[model samples]
Target: MENTYYRRIFNGCLFLVPALLLCTKNFSIGAILILLLTATWYLIKEKRNYTLDKIDWMVIIILSAYFIANIPIYLSDMETTRYFKGASRYLFIIPIYFFIRHIVTETTTPRKYLDWGIVVGAVGTIVIAIYQFYVKGMPRVDGYLYSINFGYLSCSLAFLALTLANSSHIKKILWLSFLLCCFATILTLTRGAIFAIPILIIFSVIFQSKQNKCKNIFKTILIMLVFFWGMYAYSAQFKERINFTVTEFHRILSGDVADAESSGGRIQLWYAATQSFIKSPLIGQTYAQREETIRQLYQEGKISDWPISVKRAHAHNQYFEMLASNGVLGIFAIIALIFTPLCFFLKHISKSTHALTGFVFVLGFSIFCLTEVPLEQNLISSFYGFVLAVLINFTRNDLDNIQDSET
Candidate 1:
């Protein structure tokens, strides 16, 4: 009876987890109330003491450093609102990660719990993303996201589906999910998506090589090329995406005579960031301090033609943004948080295919971060962390197991 109850609780939470982490999906205060009730039931019923691993320690340490480093900013000329808004990220995301980790550990393994969740979440998110892109179009509201964000989300969903596809036990439904993910990624017209997908394919090839996998891959790529070309030809924005990608690719290869437009306004932002860094090199500016800081920079002729009217939140590059906003310790925390899992995963590449899928996702997102600040929004961070949590779950013998005819 106790075992059945535990399994039931786990299954319910499994469904709830993905819903909470999706873009188009929302759970109300009432839902949170219900979740609290069930979670209380699970907690009260628990017998064993919990043990957190090194990853947990790493997350806590980074978040702690992030908070501690920001204390000076809060003490400085920054507003109380700005202080809390900046500080709240550590509070919100950190505990939530612990909570997520607990929920994941409740199951025997994180693999299928999240795999099933993502399959459901990805399909639903894809539908909403598609609807928003085709039916609604652009120029979104104050609180809502633009259609282009959906394009980015599409790529993210595709990446997750593709990661799941890497496992030997991929079912037909999961394969179909991958197809939808790929199709939706294309529809987004995200040029970065175009560039990033090759990582997935390359890794897929690398892992599947010497196993007679290239033939199917070649045929699939041929079909996808035809589809992409046709779709690219039809949509002006998509065509522009292709053109811009090719133009930039060529420029990068050719050592660039002209056209820095590929990473539009990135140079300007980088310049602004460096100038900001130079002024207060040690402590750097607080979240509240950014507006006035940039304003002063523009007015003083330090950063010329930088838009004063636009409220800039970040350096537009993740690494630079952290260094500028959070300072030396903050930057280190960010680095440790990102790279710890990577280093850990690299050490345990007995399952190379699974490791390669994660690598592809990381590569894709790293490229995305170069142009867009994905972590700015709560939903994006929550979704990304949750998906990554799932991908990490795939590094398992049981999950990655294939049928052995010889055995």
Candidate 2:
């Protein structure tokens, strides 16, 4: 009965993951509160159920660096803002690995159950994202599913769908669902995402390749491209974005584009971040400190007024954003935090191959994050948190296999 009660709480929390995601949309104080509460409840009642491995410590190390990046909290009001801003983003780290360890170590649930739940939920998200992107038309707020800032969530979901499909014998319904999801991804008109989708698919093909897998995968790709183009060929924005991408490629080849520079308005942000880094050099201007940093620089006539009001809330690049907000220490911490999941997954991938697919899925997300503040936005973050929580917390593979076999 006690075990069943805990499972009920766990499942209830699981359902709340999506609801809270929808409510707050991204990283939310409310969601964080709920997560912390859930963690506490488990610890207080089911004390023996709790376990955190080295991965948790690694996350702590990065987060500690981030916290240290801000000092004199009482001296400045913005210090609190910086703490929460960095902390909330970092908080997901707790739920992720800790939750996964708890699930895996508990040893009651079958591994296949977890896998199937992930497959079904992932496919469901793909379906909704597809309807939002391709058939129903893009939402005005999103410009595509989950907002324009990190709209690539749709593509990432499609990638997950494709990977799950690969792990099983192809069925007509599943294959058709995969193809529809693929078409939905392309409709978003997110250029980097368009390129990234193929990279993930190609990665899965290469990783899982067999004598016949390559041929079937290529055929699948061809069909996907044809169907996607057939549905959304009339979108001018998509065409223009592709053309701009081609132009950028040509510029790169001709030496017109500079590294850490130029692509939309990124070079400008990178330049500003660099200049800011130069002045502070140690502890950054702090998260809330950026506008003042700008104001001071602007008053001194060092930078133009035009560059001051950026649409990007933070520095456009994640690494540079940390540098701008928290300085060098923060930058390293952010990099490690963003990077460790994939590295850990890769390191232990020999123990579990399915995790490699999850790593590939994360790879596409990391790429999207490089140029855009996808994680900064609520919808994107929440979608990720909810899905990832499910990814890590779900257990019972026999149950997972049941869903897999049914499909």
Candidate 2: deviation at residue 8, Å? 3.6
Off by over 4 Å in 2: 12-36, 48-53, 62-83, 92-100, 103-146, 166-178, 210-234, 247-262, 287-306, 311-313, 382-407
Per-residue lDDT tens digits of candidate 2, residues 293-401? 6666667865556546764336667677767655676666666655765675555443344555556766877888667666555456545444443433332233344
C-alpha TM-score for every candidate: 0.74, 0.71
lDDT of each: 0.56, 0.54
Cα lDDT over the full model 1: 0.56
Q: Which candidate should be chosen as best, given lDDT against the real structure? A: 1
Which sections of candidate 1 miss by over 4 Å? 1-7, 16-25, 28-53, 62-69, 77-107, 110-113, 136-144, 166-170, 208-227, 243-262, 287-289, 292-306, 352-358, 388-407
lDDT of 1 by residue, 1-407 (tens): 76556545545555555544334443412233344465555655664477877666765664455466566656775555443343344444454444444554423454565467657766766675567566777322111354344455556656656655656365566667767766666665655565566656665565546666777678657876787788777877677767877777676467542244535345556656666566666666765466667677667865544445445546667666666665675566556545655564555554445565566566566666666666545455545454444445444332335323224
